[model samples]
Target: MASSIHDLARHLNISIGTVSRALNGRADVNADTRQRVLE
Candidate 1:
């Protein structure tokens, strides 16, 4: 099952907006950050 942005942020110890942007494929999110989320 996929986790929500809030769950991801808490799990990854990052900000919610950061997780949200990564998940939505926002340009603000770096490749490494996005890759971390995917993994």
Candidate 2:
């Protein structure tokens, strides 16, 4: 399992900020992208 936001982001091929925003439920992140992060 991913140990940190950086790991998750790297695994998902997205930026750390994107993973953080998605996890935080920020509106700026696309719903599909957020769903990917959530999964």
Candidate 3:
């Protein structure tokens, strides 16, 4: 399991900001990307 946002972002091949945005449900994040982050 991912222990932190950094780990999750690395695993997902995305930036930390993207992960943060997705988790926070920011409008700028794409729907598919958000779903992947959520999962």
* Alpha-carbon lDDT of model 1: 0.87
Clashing pairs in 1: none
Model 1, span 1-37: residue lDDT tens: 9687888889888899888888888999989989988
Model 1 residue 1 distance off true place after TM-score fit, in angstroms: 5.7
Off by over 4 Å in 3: none
Each candidate structure's count of clashing pairs? 0, 0, 0
RMSD of 3: 1.3
Encode model 3's per-residue lDDT on 1-39: one tens digit a residue. Answer: 636999989999999999999999899999999999999
For 1-39, candidate 2 gives per-residue lDDT tens digits of 636999889999999999999999899999999999999
Clashes of 2: 0
Q: Where does candidate 1 stray beyond 4 Å?
A: none
RMSD of each: 1.4, 1.3, 1.3
The CA lDDT at 24 in model 2 is 93
Local error of candidate 2 at residue 30 (angstroms): 0.6
